[model samples]
Target: MPPSDLDLLLRLRLVVARVGESDNANWWASDGVLSPTGQYAYDRIAPRTGPFARARVAFAVAQERCASQVPPGALTLWTLPADTEEAFDDRWSHWLDHVEDWAPTFAAVEAINTSSILTALVEHGLIDGQHADAARALTAAPPDPSVRLAETAHIDVDAVRQLAAGFACSQPAALVVPYVRSNA
Candidate 1:
């Protein structure tokens, strides 16, 4: 039997999330501007818990997953607090709520965000400008990804240099189009 389309789609999303998360963690670590764990984005969400203590833990977990070349083992440890069992819900988000109310969502929505972030990294030179090869390894792009991988995956990779280029232009920002639910 063969796996369904949904399975393939999910696998792609997983790859994207892992790569993106890894990049974000690395970026946060050596940006040279942060005072340990201080991220300007999260300040509005919550107060600091004695500086780098909390932020270090978060990046460590993310980087550990990257180092293993797979999702981290035993995320179940990301559970609710209270020194009791019933205080928790069996979901990642719930566990995060226990840890910090803001939680820093990076679920499947990450799939949509990865392309732009990678593009940014390439543009900013955080990662090597060998962006095209990295993109090819991660995607089965059109004009036959397998053949492209064979012919140009390793060279100067100029042909596929436009890697994931379409996505940045085609995918729109996540917009919340308002809808009126009828009052009558």
Candidate 2:
């Protein structure tokens, strides 16, 4: 394929999973809602609260990073601290707007790297794949949290190597490139 075509094929995907604060302690009491047999009570997640439940609540709270791209690019999924529902919508919207502003265009992939986006996504709850190619594809399989970093990031390798000496990732090399941990 022509270089222009390859650049045109770039894809930008963002899948973020932010940890939110919880107030529904009794959510599992089965009193909120129950199944047909009443044996299993829904965990009452953001997805569970669809129109049938009540409303669309913000999910994956923390900081949305980028996921993947079609032609193997990068994405930016901005995640924010999801605490209360009072101003959730506003915060979510603002953060999303920010990400949108910083989002990379396929046309600019050559100028700006896409690895950082994928790393951010992985830091959040975007796609989690084993291979570098898969990671750049927005695969649904999210990788483990608290990884050293990605070589794609073009970060200091020795820093990650040092971190790996202490806190290493759980996933095998089959999933992704081994990241070394850093003391910092």
Candidate 3:
């Protein structure tokens, strides 16, 4: 059976989030300096060789889906707190609440986020050795996912690039509507 349209939307959103977070180019793009195609726009300026072929394809599909469906806006980043106990606790609680809300409709994304946070905790040495092991052991299974992955059609790379180029244009600080293209 084919995936539903909503499934495609969710997957595309997830991919956009991942690529946006990973690449600084996407960060700037989200700031409206370029198209919200994230890594696709970044690769346009600075190409790199990689074993990330599959991931790249996934991101491109996500970018295209988003360009077609979701409107561009401000960029939001998920961050781990500083090493301070208060900060850590606050951040953790905030994320826990977010996951609880997300789990009901986006269990796969929630699971991915949970795993990412756990890995960050261990990697940053916030929890070490036995504590890390214990945390890992006590991890709960992700709730039933509302969406599943399926193959998507390939997006036209050149068209996305052209759109990104248009997005990179900017106006003077006080100007609105008519954009004076920045010499980037």
Candidate 4:
């Protein structure tokens, strides 16, 4: 049988955890935007396992399932950017060239906040309120620079594991990736 949407999400969380471990940084720091190291790790693993594709499928399924409760676009607030630097550069240049034209698009994107998404997810019985609360706390901005720095150094792997497991089952099978540490 094909894996369920929850299963794909769990696998994706595992990939994120592994990438974060490799970079010595919190994957949630960028609010779903993978850092360079994280991107490298994802790219390295994607071809072998297709986690991203599976994640996209899962996301699509969720969006369809929650269409009435949540706006489809809201589910993709942190969609990954294209893989090529040149594509990014071109897109950036275009945006820079037509900043005024893109203002409304930017505004619309910004209006879809994390809280609403989490609320919808919780209401739909997709995630527990505790998970949503934990996510909100993790993403909250600390006032102190020292505290922020300290927080960044620690990646909450257990929280992610718990969230994933909660979504899937009481005891989900582990995803095994042959991660080889490199000194390069």
The residue-level lDDT of candidate 2 at 81 comes to 18
Best by lDDT: 4
Candidate 3 residue-wise lDDT, 90-144, digit = tens? 4434444444443333323222322133343333333345443432333212331
Where model 3 places Cα greater than 4 Å from the true spot, the runs are: 1-3, 21-28, 31-101, 104-184
Q: Please list the C-alpha lDDT of all candidates, in the order they appear.
A: 0.29, 0.24, 0.28, 0.31
Residue range 148-171, candidate 2, lDDT tens digits: 233332323222222222111222
Model 3 C-alpha lDDT versus the unseen true structure: 0.28
**What are the clash counts of all predictions, listed in order?**
0, 28, 0, 0
**Residues 1-184, model 1: lDDT tens digits:** 0123222222222222333342342322322112222344444444443222333344345334323321222111111122211322223233344444323322222222343545543543333556434543444333321211222222111322232221222122221111111112
Write the residue-wise lDDT of candidate 4 on 22-136 in tens digits: 1222212233223333334554766433333333333343323323322222211112122322333344444445446534432232232222334334433445666655544
Task: Choose 3 or 4, whichever is better by TM-score.
Answer: 4
Q: What are the models' TM-scores?
A: 0.25, 0.18, 0.19, 0.23
* Candidate 4 residue pairs in backbone clash: none
Give the 10-residue window scoring lowest on summed lDDT in candidate 4. Answer: 144-153
Task: Choose 2 or 3, whichever is better by lDDT.
Answer: 3
Which candidate ranks first by TM-score, i.e. highest?
1
Q: Report the Cα lDDT for residue 44, model 1.
A: 44
Candidate scoring better on TM-score of 2 and 4: 4
Judged by TM-score relative to the true structure, which candidate is superior, 1 or 2? 1
Question: Cα-based RMSD of the predictions, in order?
Answer: 17.2, 15.9, 21.8, 18.4
